[model samples]
Target: MEGLKECVANLVVYLHPSKAKCPNEAILTELSSMLFTYNETFEGVVLAYDPGNCSNLAKILPGIHPYFGVKLTARILLFNPKPDMLLEGEVVKITPHSIHAVVLGFSAAVIADEDIRGEFKYKSKHGKEVYVSKSHKKHKIKVGTILRFVVKSFDEEILHLSGSLLADHSGCARWLDKNSDKWSQADRF
Candidate 1:
């Protein structure tokens, strides 16, 4: 969530001669192909796009194929997580050695045992696995729980993230929000 942002870009979408009848649709289709993939130019993964101010007249190149370029201003939503940034995700799987979560319902994140702080201990309850905080019994992480953690590294190729739970400010997001005042007061000492 921390890395999500919107940016405006001036783009030229090339269209084949056959698609000249509906240039708008052809442009949309070309931009849609960029969704959910990492682009080095944008330096992030594109989540969504909106094309605006399209030119009715396109420039037809002199090539034999006669491809035309449609110019437009586009708004793009991108996700580009960086090291030490705090991020939230849903716990999809849990084990003694590692915790697996999905960030933004797309990126996969993993927090290994070493990355998890010593304040929490892994345990089983009702045949369910969880990581429980030793200091705060109400604060725990289990499957489906929304967790906040620090980003250690990210693999842009596969949209995979390496996360850590070593900060006092990181844990169950709901619990942290609900008990913000109390947590802050306790953290002072």
Candidate 2:
């Protein structure tokens, strides 16, 4: 199924607060299913932010805002599917310095060593090969990995990267869409 994408102005997450009857597992499972469904049906782009979690909302929303393209707002509902399909334990955790978003079956790069003990190398955007510890190695990665990295530490230019490694030239953000007037404006100016 094709993924859904929509711009959201505000997302209101209803939490039970009391985890006695409605557990966090139930809540996260519902949320994940909803996100998957939304990602499959919507198009254009999607921007979601929860008002309840103000601090975290602030951090992620700003980072994703400029990439939404034309979408402005949207809403999605979440509900538990079944007992066996529930999400148990913490699915996402956010602290002052970092935010960790977890998925049950997340695939990431893993070492291909036969000895069961070795380091794995991952190439960063800067062309620097970084070695991951044996314990930190992953087997594969999902199409889009949830990174819990610090937003402040890295240089901002990395975020503006465009095009493939073969073509080191930039100014290709609107390359896929020839109808964009932004290109005309750039020519005129």
Candidate 3:
């Protein structure tokens, strides 16, 4: 808001089509500069682009603008997830049936009780008497536990993360050994 001149952000910019009308290099350079300037507001932020996330994401405004003969409107589209790697998150909810977690600035993910670890379960506090794993009696899933997971699946917004320590947890006993490195720094995540 400081030194910005009185530039009318019409949200519509017309582009020339052919080199006969406007040279390609000239248009490309000029348009690129304009786009980058405006797109600064969109940098590093996720936008609702698809119908899965928001149905009105790409919907046009109530006004109409025609270029030469064709009509034009605005739209919001998604960018790919960055770095293409596994991410860590905190388990926000722990239950007898499933574990709900969230990645930082992302979406909620789920790890079913059966999918959490190799044959792991905890007795529910309500005590309806369901099958519980005896081995997991010592280590129970609790809130705010940092869990490493991979993005199993994702749409525009929803995420399905899996806590499958496929390579790390080679065996049950090894898991206990690796995870029990120290109890002093419990809140490391």
Query: Each candidate: how many clashes?
Result: 0, 14, 0
* Candidate 3 Cα lDDT to native: 0.41
Give lDDT tens digits, candidate 3, residues 26-145.
334433453312243443223332111111122233435422221223343322233223445566776667667775545566666555545455555664323233444544445666
Task: Give the distance in Å from residue 111's predicted Cα in candidate 3 to where it truly belongs.
Answer: 0.8
How many Å off is the CA of 94 in candidate 2? 34
| Poorly placed runs, candidate 2 (over 4 Å) | 1-6, 9-25, 34-38, 44-163, 170-189
User: Which regions of candidate 3 deviate over 4 angstroms?
Assistant: 1-85, 125-140, 157-189
**lDDT (Cα, tens digit) per residue for candidate 2, span 30-82:** 34544422232332122232322222221112352322111113344322122
Which candidate has the highest TM-score of all? 1
User: How far in Å is the alpha carbon of 71 misplaced in model 1?
Assistant: 0.3
Q: Which ten residues in a row have the lowest lDDT in candidate 3?
A: 1-10
Worst 10 residues of 2 by lDDT: 161-170
TM-score of each: 0.95, 0.19, 0.39
Candidate 2 yields a Cα-based lDDT of 0.26
Question: Tens digits of per-residue lDDT for model 1 on 1-189?
Answer: 699989999998899999998888889999999999999989999999988789887999888899999899999999999999999999999999999999999999999999999989999989899999998999999999999999999999999999999888888999999989866886798
Best by lDDT: 1
Which scores better on lDDT, 1 or 3?
1
